[model samples]
Target: MSERANAMRASILRSHGGPEVLRLSELPAPVPTSGETLIRVGAAGVEPGLDVRTRLNGAGWQLRFPHVLGASMAGTVISSPDAAAPDPGTRVAVAPNISCGECAYCRSGRDNSCAQREFLGIHHAGGYAEFCSVPTRNLIPIADSTSFAVAASTAVSFGTAWHLLVTRARVSPADVVFVVGAAGSVGTAAAQIAALFGARVVLGSRTPQNLRELSDEVRALGVVDTTTDFAPQLESIAPGGVDVVVETVGSDTWAGSVDSLAPEGRLVCCGGASGGEVGLTLRDLYRRNLSLLFSTSSTFEDLRLVLRLVDEGRLRPRVDKVFDLADAAAAHAAVEAGGLQGKVVIVPESAA
Candidate 1:
C-alpha cells in the first residue's frame, strides 16, 4: 500500500473549545496490537452531553492533543492477532467502557463502577476516524441486519438507560416513572425502557414542541413542560408524585425531580448536562423517604442486553442525522444546539 493508503481520515481535536476545534486530517491508521482488533469505523454516535462537553472543556478529564472524540461506534473488524478475537469482516459494536476484569466490580458484574475503568474518546483514540484499534474483549458481534448507525447509537444511551431504570431504580409495573430531558437520546431510551417494563412513564422537556411530540411518539402517560414550574404539572399527572424520577438534566431540574417524587420514591441520575451542583434539604429527604442514586456508564452486561433487545426488535434506536467524517465539526454544533429527538451519527467518508 502507498503511504497515503496506509493513512486514514479523522476528525481530530488539536485544542479544546468550540466545535471549530475539530478538524479533518489524515492520521496514520491504527494497527491492532496483541489482543486488540483494528476496525474500519462505519458509524460513531455523537452524544450531546458527553461529546459536546468534551469538545468545550475536555469534560474535566485530562487530554492529549489531537484527540478523537466519539464515545460509541460500530464497524467491521479488519484483523486481530488474537485467535480468540472475532474474524476479520465481522460487524460489531464497540463497547466504550474498559475495565480490569480482576476488579471486584467486574467480578460482581458491576464493571461500570470498576476503579480502573477507562473510556474511549476520553482515555484513548476513538471512532471519529476511518479506523480505530479496540481491545478484542470490547468487540461485541452485531447481527448482519443491524445497521452500523443503529448499533453505534445503542450502547451508550440504551445501556445507560437500562442501568439506571432496571438496575439502579428497579422500576416496577406499578411504578409511575418520570423521565426528565425526554427529548435527548438517553432520556428517550429511558422513557421507552421504563414503558417496556410496564411502568407509567411521563416525559419532560424544556422545548414544548419537542416534548409534546416525544410524549406522543413514546406514548408516555403524560407530559411536563419544563420551561415553567413543572412540579404542579407533574402533580396532576401522578396525583401525589411519581414513584421513580429519571434525572438526566441536572441542576436545572434537580430540585423539581426531588419534589416530584412520592414517598419511598427513587431518583436515578445518570448525567448533568445542564449543571452538576444542586442544593439538598435534609428534611425533605427524611420526610419523603426518597432514595437518591447516581450511575455512570453501563456495564458489559447492560450493553449486551440492550443490543440483544435492539436486534430482536424490542427496542428501537433512533438516529437523528448522519454526517460525513469531514463534517464532524458541524455534527458537534448540531448536538450543542439541542432539541434533537435522537442521536446524531458521524459516518466516516470511506464508510459512507
Candidate 2:
C-alpha cells in the first residue's frame, strides 16, 4: 500500500465546545492490535447523548486530543488477527460497548453493568473516520441485504431499547407501554419493540405531526402531544395509566412520566438528554407503588438480538439524514438542534 493508502480521513475533535470543534483531517489508519480487527467504515450513527453532549461538555470522559466520536457504526472488515472474527470483506456492525467477559456481570448476562466497560467515542477512538480498529468481539456480521446506514443506526438505539423494555421493564401483551420522546432514534425503536412484544404502545412527542406519523407507522395505540401538559392527554389515551413507561427525556418528562404510570407501573430510564436533575415526590411514589429502573448501554447479546430483528424486518432502523465524513460538524449541529425524528448518520465520502 502507498503512504496515502495508509492514511485516512477523519473528523477530529480537538477541543470540546461546539460542532465547529469537529474538523476534517487526515490521520494514519488505525492498525489492528492483537484481538482487534480493522474495518473500512461505511456509515456511523450520531448519538445525541454521547456525541453531541460529549462534544459540548466533554461528558467527563478522559480524552486525548483530536478524538473520533461516533457511537455506532457498520462497515466491511478489512483484516483481523482473531480467528473468531469475520473474514475480510464481511459486512459487520460494531458493538459500541466493550466489557470484560470475565466480570460477574458478563457471566450473568448483564454485561452492560460490567465495571470494566468502556464505550466507543467516549473511552477510545470510534467510527468518525474512514477506517476504525475495533475489538474482534465487538464485530457482529451483518447480512448483505442490510444497508450500511440501517445497520449503523441499530446498535445503540435498538439495543438500548431492547434492554430497557425487554430486560428492565418486562413489557408484554398485557401491558400498555408508553414511549416518551417518541421521535428520537431510541424512542422510535422502543415503541416498535413494545408493539412487537404485543403491548399496546403509546407514543409521546412534542411535535404533533411527527408523533402522529410515528404512531401510525408503529401501529401505536395512541399519540400524546407533550408540548404542554401531557399528563391529562396521557390519561385520555390510556385510561388509568400505562403499565410500562419508557423514559429517555429525563427531567424534561420525568414528572409527566411518573404521572402517566399506573399503580406498580415500571418506569425504565436510559437517557437524560434534556437534563439530569428531576424532582420526585416520595409520597406519591410509595402510594402508587411505581418502580423506577435505570439502564445504561446494552449487552452484546442485546445488540445481536436487535440486529437479527432489524435484518429480519421485525424492527426497522430509521436514518433521518446522511452526511459525509467531512460534514460531521453539520451532523452534530443537526443532532444538537433537536426535533429530529430519526438518527443522523455520517458516512465516508466514498461510501456517500
Candidate 3:
C-alpha cells in the first residue's frame, strides 16, 4: 500500500461480544468503485442497541466479521467513479439503506420493503472510519448552513419517525398522538414530527428528566403534552384515546401503546431498542379495529423529506455529543448506559 493510504483509521468488530471488541486500527483507505463515491467521514450516528447487536452479533443478520459499524453518516466527497457523482469536497449525508432498484418495491417508491435491500455496517463495510465508500445514488447534499453531525443523525431517527407518522399512520392536524419512549432518538424525532403535523402530541417516557427535557425541546415546534404515566395520561387528555401511538421501545411499552389508542387508531412501530418481545390478542385487535403497522428502516425518499425539513428548519436532530473516531468503544458504552436525549455522533480527526 502507498504511504498515504496507510494512515486511515477505523473501528472494526473482529468478533462479537461487547463494546471491548471494537478496535481502532490503521487500515487502507477505501477506493471508490464504479458508481460509488469515497467519503471523508465527518460524522456518524450511533443507535445504542443496534451497535450493541452488531458488536454482539445478535442482530439476526449475517456478518463477514471484521466489520465497520455505522448506519447513518455525513461527510465530504473525496473521490467518485462516475461523472454524475457529487464532486469532491461536496458535503453530503450518506443514506445507508440501499435497496435494489429493480425490485417492485423500489419501483413503487416503497423501497424500504425491497427484498434485496442492503444496509451499511450490516450488509457491507460502513462509515466507522476515516474513509468509506457508498453508492453514488445514496448521497444527499448537506446544506452549508447545517453541521455534519446533524446530517448524520437525521436519516435513521428522523426518517424512521417520518415514515411512521406521516407515511404509515397518516398523522394529520386533527390527530392526538402519543409517542412512547419519547426521550430516545427515535422517540424525540417522533414527537417532533407528530407535532409538526399540528397533532396534539403526548410524549411519554419512564424517566422524568428525559421527559421534561424532550418536552421542552419539542414545545417550540408545536403543541405537546408529556407524561411518565402512559395510559392514565392519555386517558386524562384524550379520554376516548389517541389517534396514533408511535411505539419504538417495544415490549414494555407495547401493551400500553395498544391500549392508549382510540378505535381504529394506528400503532406504528419501527424498532424495539429495549430488546424483548410482546404479545397481543387477535380478538382485541379485531374488536378495536386498530391498525398495527410494522415499519423498518427509512426509504430513500423519506431521507430526502427529512433533509428538506432540516433545511427548512422545521425539523432538527438533538445531538448529545461527538466522539472522536478512536473513541468508538467509549461511544458504544455511553449509548448502552442509556439516559441520552439524542444521538452520539462519531467524527474523524480529519474532519475535526
lDDT of candidate 2 at residue 134, scale 0 to 100: 91
Writing each residue's lDDT as its tens digit, candidate 3 over 106-212 gives 99999999999888878878889988899989999989888899998898889889989999999999888888778788888998898788888777776645567
In model 1, which regions exceed 4 Å deviation?
Answer: 1-5
Whole-structure CA lDDT of model 3? 0.83
The 10 consecutive residues of candidate 3 with the worst lDDT sum are: 220-229
Candidate 2 matches the true fold with a TM-score of: 0.97
Report, for every candidate in turn, its global Cα lDDT versus the true structure.
0.89, 0.89, 0.83
Residues 1-352 of candidate 1 have per-residue lDDT tens digits of 2244589999999998999999999888887899799998999999765677888987778889979988899999888889999988999999999899888889999999999998888899998999999989999999988999999999899999999999999989999999998888888899889878988889988875776656766678788888788988888888979999999989999999999989999999997878989999999998989899999879999999899889888888888889999999999999888768788999987786
TM-score on alpha carbons, each prediction: 0.97, 0.97, 0.94
C-alpha lDDT of candidate 1 relative to the true structure: 0.89
lDDT-better candidate, 2 vs 3: 2
Writing each residue's lDDT as its tens digit, candidate 2 over 198-246 gives 9999988877687766788768878888778888888788888989999
Model 2 residue pairs with clashes: none
